[model samples]
Target: MSKVVLITGGSSGIGKAIGDYLSSRNYTVYGTSRNPDTIQNSLFPLLKMDVCNLESIESAISELIEATGKIDVLINNAGVGITGPIEETPTEEMKKAFDTNLYGPINVIKTVLPYMRSQKRGHIINITSIAGYMGLPYRGIYSATKSALEITIEAMRMETLQFGIKMTNVAPGDFATNIAAGRYHAPVLENSPYKEAYSSTLKMMNEHVDHGEDPSKMAKVVHQIIENENPKIHYKVGAPMQKFSIVLKRILPDKVYERMLLKHYGLK
Candidate 1:
């Protein structure tokens, strides 16, 4: 029998690419989205799920397990991003991001663990980002959410090992996707003291994403993780420079690393 894989935010971009790739490879793929109708044309079935809502997350998982018997893999790929100075970013926007990017994955895992425990075998893949390693200038809140998720996922792996559940956080670098269309941006450019700085950084950031890695590349990484009996605790998917940044974060002095980031984004 094919392994049943459940991926969140699969309506488009990275999630969609993963679902399609896995389905083609004969994995029993199911994706969750806010609107299943919108992705009816997709290769896999999509369950209606607003990951930020516990009731909705619970309902989606219950429905999936009821029909499929078990979810062999859970990919926590649903997330949103935000940008602005930490001081000036609106509280509501940050809350919205934390709800979706961090809390959503936490709640979904809580809901699914019972089934995985019963089966004594499962893999939970949390899709984070390289920015999580070191917070970005304009994207501080967004990076914080990912960093927090990475830390949480670390503990989850240790706790669930007894149940033979494998867990890992995949930190993707800038990947070409439609995330910009859904991003929650701050209104800092018009009246903020850092208006010029924000503009320059924003342009650089957007261009970087425009030329980022292919989303399909991350899908391949997912496939490899699924096939490997013991995958690494964290996987960073991107070009050499992007992946190596994580290493730089580990080895560089705080002041030097900070300077590098500032210079890279033209914030200096």
Candidate 2:
């Protein structure tokens, strides 16, 4: 029997790439997107779901479960990136970032855990980022959200192990995706003292993304993890740079690592 995989935020980027790859592998794939019109493949069933909306998430999952009877894999890949200095980031904007990036995934997992528990078998992959491990200058808010996700996935992994379910966190370092260009910008604050600093940081981030890895490569790692019977708790995508970053963060002092991150992104 073909595995049934459900991917949130599968409308585009890495999520879309994974959906496309899985379909090619003969998996019965279902993707959820806020904008169904933007989805590339019409052949796979695409449901309109906003991860920030609990009702929409539940309804979509319910419909899928009713139709397919099981979700062998769930990909919590939906997220948003907000760029700005910590001091300049508005309260509302911060809330929105957390809602979609952190809490939204938690809600989806809660709703799906029951079915997964009943089946006593499933895989949950949380799409995190290198930012989760090391904070960036203008991306503090975005990094925090992913950091929360990383911590949550760790705890969830320990709890779910005995249930015969698996949880893997995919932390891909700079992938060439719409994310760099599609950052959610907060309303410009006039008379803000740090505006210049934030602008310089955002510009550096943009330039770094211009030379990042392709999103399709990240998709293949996702496919490999899905097919593995005993997947690792974390899958770091991208080139050796990703592993190097993790190792550097682990061994370097706070100031040294911060400086390296700034220099790596041209913020130095």
Top lDDT: which candidate number? 1
lDDT per residue, candidate 2, 81-106, as tens digits? Answer: 89887776788999999999999999
Assess candidate 1 and give its TM-score to the true structure: 0.98
Q: How accurate locally, in lDDT, is each candidate?
A: 0.92, 0.86
| lDDT for position 57 in model 1 | 96
Which lDDT tens digits does candidate 1 get at residues 57-169?
A: 99999999988999999999999989988888889999999999999999999999999999999999999999898888999999999999999999989999999999999
User: Cα RMSDs of all predictions?
Assistant: 0.9, 1.8
Candidate 2 local lDDT, residue 167 = 95
Using TM-score as the measure, the top candidate is 1
Cα deviation in Å at residue 151, candidate 1?
0.4
Which stretches of model 1 miss by more than 4 angstroms? Answer: none
Please give the distance, in angstroms, between residue 41's alpha carbon in candidate 2 and its true position after superposition. Answer: 4.0
